[model samples]
Target: RTLPCSGRNLLPSTCGENRRRVVRALATREPNLRPGIPDLNVLRSGIAAVLSVALAWALRSDSLLWASPVSVVPQQWITEQRTISGVVVSVSDGDTFRLQNVGPFHPTQDRHHEQSFPVRLAGVDAPEISHFGNPAQPFSEEAKEWMKQELLGKSVAVHILGRDQYGRIVGSVRYTSGLFSHDLATELLRRGFATIYRGRGASYDGDLSNLEATEINAKAQGVGIWSLPDEELPAEYKRRTRARAF
Candidate 1:
């Protein structure tokens, strides 16, 4: 007799015997099964794992560093410049600020819906503010105070560059009109509140010559942090402070 499904000849074979052999073969080849469907046990395990991840995601109160599947499509980074209009709500420091009521010039479905978020000034590095009992970097307070007086509650246009690792938008902030029409970062450099940040992996499409020139002028004028004979860069100051703590 020959089984119709498998087309295999079975001498003195019973239907029950043929069925048992077929089941055994399937079990043996389960790992290499076509269509990639796992056996019942493995399928159950996969389902459980998926359920666990979903539950964890749902229960998470804050940011989760979830591992996502590799995407086939290339991610579209913000290479092209974008302009947004918003009023400064808060100044975190000389080079970082918070904006409220932000709206993009060209609205799209993918545009951020949040009314406010942190903005880090591009092409500039400001002195670090005091925190956790660590001494503030030279001119840190002056930088923050200057920003507060000049930017807080003021409407401005943000020339979007890209986002930083801390999720803050990196951009060149400028007033829409008036005497203070130049980029905020350049102004900070001119006032010696910030230095031209040319650190590795820095990304800023805007011309940095103005920032460099302003910084040189500030240093020559002995203004702000430049007045200190041995002022340390903000990054160096942070490294030294952290080293001292431990």
Candidate 2:
């Protein structure tokens, strides 16, 4: 007779008892084996569940990473008006100086509380000083010395305007206890030690007209740097000197 599993009679009648015993064993185990085997539909459902959870977590992490940089973007464009009182520690040039004990200003940050910061005088560009074997532009020494006398060790009120590309705070400084309130940039321009920066994107906040007038008067009187024949602007002088180095 043919066996139900193999569809062919491979055993003779002498082995009939052995075949009957083997058939009975398989029949008894078949029910347990079917339950022990994994179902394809159940396996696919479990994998899908795990992938969905991982995808959700990844999207949340990506959103947080994208938001971090946007939150910390520097506020360079937002102009804030702040008045700070500090003593001039050093003068870098006519247009730049170091101020100490700067504090009590608006938007109080720990860094500005009692530290020294380099300040670049806004709305003016001073002549280039002779340093590092570079030739001094006209009136550079005079400009520096003038600022030294007027501001060194002197307490002044600084009108914080913005920041320059070199990361220096740009402001208008005036002596607080002098006989006459002296705006440092105007003073420099009046003496012809510096020039009004009239380049594109120059922001003096309505003081450009006044600064230009002062510069014109200085030029007419032939004072300081204006007295030199065909004096080069400080910016142009720096560029030409740097080019020569190459």
Candidate 3:
């Protein structure tokens, strides 16, 4: 007798349960099936089970929609946002690094034309390192060196927000070792190597109070960048550099 309802005709959401039921029904009536002929029901179920497992694995492999703890990526960037894990290949400055082996290609991959992706620490801005032989800001090299020591060769989880105007990925980075974990931006602010990003177009998705509190404490102690009686904000420095270009 033909196996009625192979579940291939049903809606996708209902297929799993229906398939399981069909498999159970077939198992119970196995002896009743033709003595010499093969049972088509068992073969069909086996195929279904394998296909279902493959589909599920493919979906899980998609890094673009993996669920994560509350991220700093703004709501507008959700569709293009995601999390990726990779080893830190290089540190550009206090707030930027290149991550390699991020696993699976993504639409928001930086335009750097390389395997490693560039990521900017979200919600904070570090001192600017000179480009094109321009003057470097105070503690710029220190910031870079500190980041290298902290992140170089270590694995990190990057919560991608979106691309910056420079085409670098803007996101939050979390570093976990043993039983302790810390957010990269928060630590930078706590040490005064960076400041709360007050620039326009820089927005975060969650509560801003914690970052603000960390900055306040760092400033109170007058450490790092805050130690300068009249420190030039990174934004101001960039603006000044632009004005001089003309």
Candidate 4:
């Protein structure tokens, strides 16, 4: 079952994990779903993913929103709802990935994707060139570049939330290339390129504030943007600029 994007507290009663995986799903994947109790694990994870992917196709009903260099695609669309798993074959930017399985589809019947997927980041907002200044902030480009470099052409485990407003897969970028990885929010903070977007008033996004504090500490240490006085504007002005755009 799917839950609201703003509901983090709901997960404690849903998934066995203490943290809210629901928020992770919605914020990252923006899936179409009504709140319900869900179990998180290998089998359940596959089912939820396929459910979301099928739902996304139904909502979109258009052309392919994404493609990848080496994607595992099905010759036919999902005719029935089922779970599937795969590695990310591509990353669109800071928050989106294209995934297709490697080796072989999960041996479990109805447990894997034979096609690639295009997914959206759920909760956090990274600086898009469109939202930046007229020419766009140089740092925004840097941030995107860094994100692409870091995750592009990597293998990732995706957890689905269903379709979003645009019908893209709503999932998180977990393990990549058989290694643990940081989500977009963490990378943004690590690079000193983003803020929590507190004004947008997202639920799990506040969790990003914890990362923001880490960014502050990194800045204090003169890292990334902090290394440059010109790019380092007062917090108040930074907020104003971001607000005006997004």
Candidate 5:
């Protein structure tokens, strides 16, 4: 019987295979062995290769570049079967907010950090940052800041709509009201903070939000967000997104 020469020929789990392959590859690359001078050229080339690999690993430890794509890492189950309730940790500006959801849900199954979900307001667009301070309007920053203040550190409820195109939970979010006076999005519109974002006809959600929008506008000529500069109109916001300007 012939002795195994490499890993391909070995049965399995041979610790010597790696060392054997490396030594064989080194020898194959330099067929002639100098008896006394130590084969400086081949030795130098081997050292250079080792140093290059070491350098790449060292750099990858600190930077994402040169790192292997983590495509093979198995994804864990995240969406579970319990309703979550918590104070909003932060509002990532209009349309998206984060919730803590302390007790009602436990992350015994999730592998992600910080149990926060991004929420999208179903029906509106408030003034964009670019809409501020021009002859067009004055409250763009104030609107954004107001949204932050209201949602952050306050109680809110989120209805999970599964995941969206941007990996956010496409859900309806409303502030916590002891009296259940209004949902968060409707109240935001009433206070002139957020505007309704109508969905495409095919995927339109319940008409409740649409009616809320009308009621909000009926009050005080669209007082808060309704009074934004016409340049920052809802239609323009849609175009800006479809056009991918921002």
Candidate 6:
């Protein structure tokens, strides 16, 4: 006769075989134990191990990392769709700005207990302004000054796309004043203050073709940076500078 264990019934034949195996294993481990009896300690340990494994399996997720805790910081802003709204407090360039009053929490570089962070425009690259004594690219100041006038102290909606290598939030910025609404990237491209970003992870909201058309029109009109005959792309300029440094 085979006894049921742990509220589960087993086939009589299989249960008898399993019992014999356990008895043999226990006897080998404890040489002085009675022939048909298992040590109470051994029985308790075996039950504990079985329960632990069952509990672990129950909590397992599809991810290989097991059951990971939910992050306080959101990890899937790009694919999962996340957005943050705040006022543009500062304009660094045609395609970069500082946003504040997001919340009581800031993801990076919290200053004086204020929720503020820098945001880089997705799907566009503006000319580099003079920094560290480097000469400014043509129309860099024009781009920056124009953005400051247009965006400084304005409330805007940011659609988060991803984070850049520099740890800046990369997103699409939408500005609304009265009844007029405009996207920062499209406006920059339209005025030739910036170019379509061809780098990796160049994400944007809305139709991509619209931005392309805007850039094409700017080029046809020979306006802003397009007026220069030998205008260098910001990405290309950065590469050249790095190569020269090396």
Relative to the true structure, how large is the alpha-carbon lDDT of every model?
Answer: 0.71, 0.72, 0.75, 0.52, 0.53, 0.74
Tens-digit lDDT track of model 2 for 1-246: 556444365543455688788767767864344757887777899999998997577434421111121122124322545555666778898789987643234222332313567888888999998886898887898999989998887677767677778777777777844468877788899999999876544567568888899999999999998998898999898778889888
Q: Which pairs of residues have clashing backbones in candidate 5?
A: 123-196, 123-197, 124-195, 124-196, 124-197, 174-184, 175-184, 192-224, 192-225
**Candidate 3 residue lDDT tens string, 133-203:** 67999988888898998888777887777788887788888897568998888888888899889886685
Best-matching candidate per TM-score = 3
TM-score of each: 0.61, 0.61, 0.66, 0.44, 0.50, 0.64
TM-score of 3: 0.66
Tens digits of lDDT, candidate 4, 75-145:
23222212234555555555556656443333323323435557665444455453334445446667667
lDDT of 1 by residue, 1-246 (tens): 434443465422455776777767866873556685658888899999998997687434132111111211112223545565666777888889876633333233322324457888888899999888987888999999989988877777777677778877787777744664767887888888988777765755557676677888999999988999899998788778889989
Lowest lDDT sum, 10 consecutive residues, model 6, at 62-71
Per-residue lDDT over 98-172 for candidate 6, one digit per residue giving the tens place of the 0 to 100 score: 777343233334322234577899989999988766678888989999899888766677787778898788888
lDDT of 5 by residue, 84-143 (tens): 345566666555676555433334244132655566565555555543332333455676
User: Lowest-lDDT window of 10 residues in candidate 3?
Assistant: 65-74
Model 4 off-target regions past 4 Å?
1-85, 101-115, 130-134, 161-163, 176-181, 199-209, 225-246
Q: By lDDT, is 5 or 6 better?
A: 6
Provide the clashing-pair count of each candidate structure: 0, 0, 0, 14, 9, 0
**Model 1: residues with Cα > 4 Å off, grouped in runs:** 1-79, 103-115, 176-180
How much is 105 displaced in model 4, in angstroms? 7.1
